[model samples]
Target: MNQTAGLAVGHYILLKDPITGNPLAGNPRKIENIDVATRTVTWGTAYAPVNVTMNAVKVLFHNAAFETFGRVDSGGYLTLADQAAPEGSPANAAWLWSDGTSRALRVRTKDGITSSLNNGGTGTVAMGDTDRTPAASVHQCGVIVTTGTLTSHRLLTLPPATDTDAYGKWIDNTCTGAFSVVVRQSTGATVSVPNGAKAYVWLDSRGVTKLM
Candidate 1:
């Protein structure tokens, strides 16, 4: 039974279905091997032996990579430890997906346009001694310049956007505190804005917050 006898050059021999975790069923769909000891096999000895690999898979995680040849778990699945990485690298694990035991089948991401950045608009937020956290809509208006008078230190929490999120703000610390407007995302670290300063905040594809 020659599996590659009539197959085309670019035939995609699917070892397993990643979404459903199913193996390539039937004999015609799979090429059999004489033994499992050897990693590479040659089709014909009479002619020049073309090396064919049974399975060569490399799963990347964090700052390293792991590879295995012709190795399957009890479930007939390659069974990567349910991992993912930033599109650029495996080290950028800033934002995490759902804490699930299985890998995602598919993922979708879109760039978020703040109201101001989207339409060249501007808005003014009036700060108060009590009202420090403004609504998410206030930040959407492209560029923001804050107004208000403070008597003590205050924090202004900014809402995070979707992928590729960014906004610019001119902080007017009217309060008499050491740090007037300390900006931060709900789930991110903080960047303090002293008495008077300007900051452009951005979130990359991983949604890690940073001052741009």
Candidate 2:
């Protein structure tokens, strides 16, 4: 359960009220330590100590630093505490978040990464002649397959990059008929990918670049 909250000053995540999204109303106790192994949280100090056992719960991250990412676990451990997902007993569940129109979870499912533009699947985007900038899911994809025939030298324009954005996609011009997809970026030079050839497009601080 994701409980959105204004970022505080530290990495301390409030243990939400079991019944409400409001911070656990009490005499404030700053968390000083977290032991993932023992599944215990310790606050206060040696003289006035406090500890509580965590039963596999997801806590909303609070702090101005996390305003962009919103929520996180393990203080950016970026690793699961347990083994694989769907552990017959433990059942490592994958988390999902939504705020922007296009964002995806990197967690793997039963089979593998899918190529669907819907449901935030990390996959491919099938484009026709008129498609300009592909969706974020397609930008995350390793390959992009076009299926349309453009009248002129198709301008495969890409979107501008932001601080939180970085992606690369392979252009596979599998469209009907023959028309070159001119991969161009606003701040960088352009590369015309032949109808039957491929080229890699990625973003850097200076903007998008193509690697043929």
Candidate 3:
């Protein structure tokens, strides 16, 4: 008889029933594959219910980026590291970020640095820069007017509607005018008054000279 025609249907038994001496079915479903070298058939199934196959799996090491490493909490924010300019940069030339953009910042040759902390109507700043080193400056406000001998420029602030008496005094300085006030300083110290740096004053008379 012809070998192909003489072949009979064969059944495969996967798992053996614990109680009955019968071959279990259902799982290890029917599968077929042809082996070219040995010219044989091979098939198998998952060890458990969920069958998974792996064909083109690619694992890349050192190719992953950290996400949310320094995530800000509900009432927190992200912080940036300190940065400095290379050697030889004009002492007056510093880095400043106006809004969200950074650019070359400079003070007048006659002016020093006048860093101020003022709260605009938006309660936000328009510029800032930091110098980190043996003396790490986390935050420096006001204008950086490092020009000549001075360290900063005039820090001008505006007072709230209160303090009609004090407000008038600032206007008389010729240095003060309009709805704003100017606080000039020598070093980090206030020009004349203690802690009287420039700012937009906005507190009750009982409080210290308010800085805007």
**Taking the tens digit of each residue's C-alpha lDDT, what string does model 1 give over 67-171?**
432246898875433334324522322322321344342221222221222234455667766446665556554465667666665667666645545544544
Q: TM-score: which candidate is best?
A: 2
Model 2 lDDT per residue over 1-212, tens place:
22224432224565565555555543244455555554455654222546654443446554423223343466774422322222232233333233133343344322232233344343344555664776654644566666566765776666666546666767887655566877666666666777767778776556667765
Going through the candidates in the order shown, the clash numbers are 5, 1, 23
Report how far residue 37 has shifted in candidate 1, in Å. 35
lDDT of 1 at 112: 28
By lDDT, rank the candidates, best first.
Answer: 2, 1, 3
Regions of model 3 farther than 4 Å from truth: 1-74, 86-212
TM-score of every model?
0.36, 0.41, 0.15
What TM-score does candidate 1 get on C-alpha atoms?
0.36
lDDT of 3 by residue, 116-171 (tens): 12331112221112111110011132221211112223342322223442331121
Identify the superior model by lDDT, candidate 1 or candidate 2: 2
What is each predicted model's overall lDDT from 0 to 1?
A: 0.45, 0.53, 0.28
